[model samples]
Target: MAEKAKVYFTDFRCPSWRENLPQKLARLMMTAGFGDIEMEGKYVAVKMHFGEPGNLAFLRHNWARVVVDLVKSQGGKPFLTDCNTLYVGGRKNALDHIESAYLNGFNPYATGCHILIGDGLKGTDEVEVPVEGGEYVTAAKIGRAIMDADVFVSLTHFKGHEQAGMGGCLKNIGMGCGSRAGKMEMHSAGKPYVKEKKCVGCHACAKICAHGAPVIENGKCAIDQNKCVGCGRCLGVCPKDAIEAANDEAPDILNKKIAEYTKAVVAGRPCFHVSLVQDISPNCDCHGENDAPIAPDIGMFASFDPVALDQACADAVAAQKPLPGSVLFDKDSGCDCGRDDLLYANHPDTDWKVCVEHGEKIGIGTRQYELVKI
Candidate 1:
């Protein structure tokens, strides 16, 4: 058996006289050995999600400010970053992505760090990273800017997810850091398809596709799977949202792929992870709107082992009863089965355990942890 990883935790409560949430968060991070990283003069990428426009559940700029300050204190150059979305959204391009971050109060003045859209303007900038011992992904297409960083830090918002069961440290660093093509590879089995009703045959997808997979027939476009390398460029260029990536991968595979991508990012780099289990929303922040939290705010967790940190958080959330008016509470209240499995209860189609298990299997970290409360 392996030794347990140490996961440091703290509740949201702060005494009126002492430190505020941000200051307390700083203390929590320091206590968890964040300052031990040799960040002197290194380029540290602070990967995080700048929530989709209209989704108010994303982490506040204040949280990022604390992290930026910490990095600066350690003489590291830090930047806030996330890759362009594969789907049509405010953050599909670099210009729009920066604007979305700025609009969401993540401006340089607010977070004390410049924002860099991980993938380039059109979501094509990428670096192929070979995943060591990867089962699902041989190589991961990561954003070039993220791969260029000397050190990596994941500032994650822990919450329930519609697909991966739970969006925690691994999801934030893995799925969030992938380039558009990389995202498509993880979510789909093969290629994308055109929604006939939504296709206008404008040739937008074909114009951007280097593979020429989008062929026009009868004034509508259909992707030629044989010609397609699953680059996912067509999905972004389609104005009508007609081209959709295949969502055929089973939940377990999706989770494993996420773990593999995570390995690609952190494999030869110094990394630290921090997850604030607040805004316990029922879906990923990628959604245009966020649902109410299924549970009350838990706390902040920090660790060098992302798998252990995530497992600790999942355990914490599982122990609590769902909030009175939350969607999970409503559903569980009407059922005879227990609601202890709050994450699965929130999204039945996904098994959050698969991600952590695979993450441990790949030598990222251990799920067995000693939760040290502060």
Candidate 2:
């Protein structure tokens, strides 16, 4: 049997004379061996989701400030970062992504660090990284800025996800660090297609493609599937946003790909993960609107092993009763929920365990963990 990884936890309860939640979180991270990492004058990529516009359940900037301060104390140049979305949204481009992040109060004044959209403007900047021991993807197209970092740290908001089951440390680093093209590859096995009505005969796609995939005629563009390599470059350069990725990958494969992508990002790097199990929304922060929390606020968790950290957080959530007025509670009240897994109860179509199991299989970290309360 593999030795269990240690995951540190702390509750939200704070006495008037005692330290607050943020302070407690800092202590928890320290206890989890965050200070032991060699971070003297290194560029640390603090990967996290800047909630989509109108999503109120996303993590607040105050929590980020605590992380920023900790990184600074260790002489690490930390920056908050997330890649642009593959779908059309407020964060589809670098300019819009920064705007949305600022709109959500992740400004430098609040978080005490600069915000760098992982992918450059238009979500095209990327570095092809080879995923060792990967069965789904061999090379993952990760954001150039994220790949340039000397250290990687994930600050995740643990929540229910419609596709990947649960949004935890792996979700934050893997999917969040991928460039737009990377996201396309993970979400779809098919190549991108052009909306003839939306295409303005820009020929921009043709110009960007090394392969002659974009065929143009009659003021319209279409991807030639035979020639298309699915690099997803055309999707970024099209001025009219006419091209769209086919998000047809199954949930199980998507989860496995997420694990592989995470392996590519964290391999041969000093990494630490922190997840706050509060505002357990039933959907991702990528959603413009958030539903009520599925479970009550649990606490914060920190560990060197992201897989173990996620497993610990998920187990913590599984132990909680569903929050009243939430979708999970509604399902439980209606009939037998069958399982104690709150994430699955919230989104029955998804199984959060797949990602962690794959992560362990890929040598990222073990799912077995010893949760130490702080």
* Best-fitting candidate, scored by lDDT: 1
In the range 93-203, model 2's lDDT, one tens digit per residue, is: 999899999999999999999999998997888999999999999999999999999999999999999999899999998899999889998999998999888899989
Task: Give per-residue lDDT, candidate 2, residue 323.
Answer: 84
Give the RMSD in angstroms, all C-alphas superposed, for model 2: 1.6
Clash pairs, model 2 backbone: none
Candidate 1 lDDT by residue in tens digits, 56-156:
99999999999999999999999999999877788988998999988899999999989888888877899999999999899999999999999999999
Where in model 1 is the C-alpha error above 4 Å? 333-339
Instruction: Compute each candidate's TM-score over C-alphas.
Output: 0.96, 0.96
Give the root-mean-square deviation of each candidate in angstroms.
1.5, 1.6
Best candidate per TM-score, number? 1
Over 4 Å off, model 2? 333-337
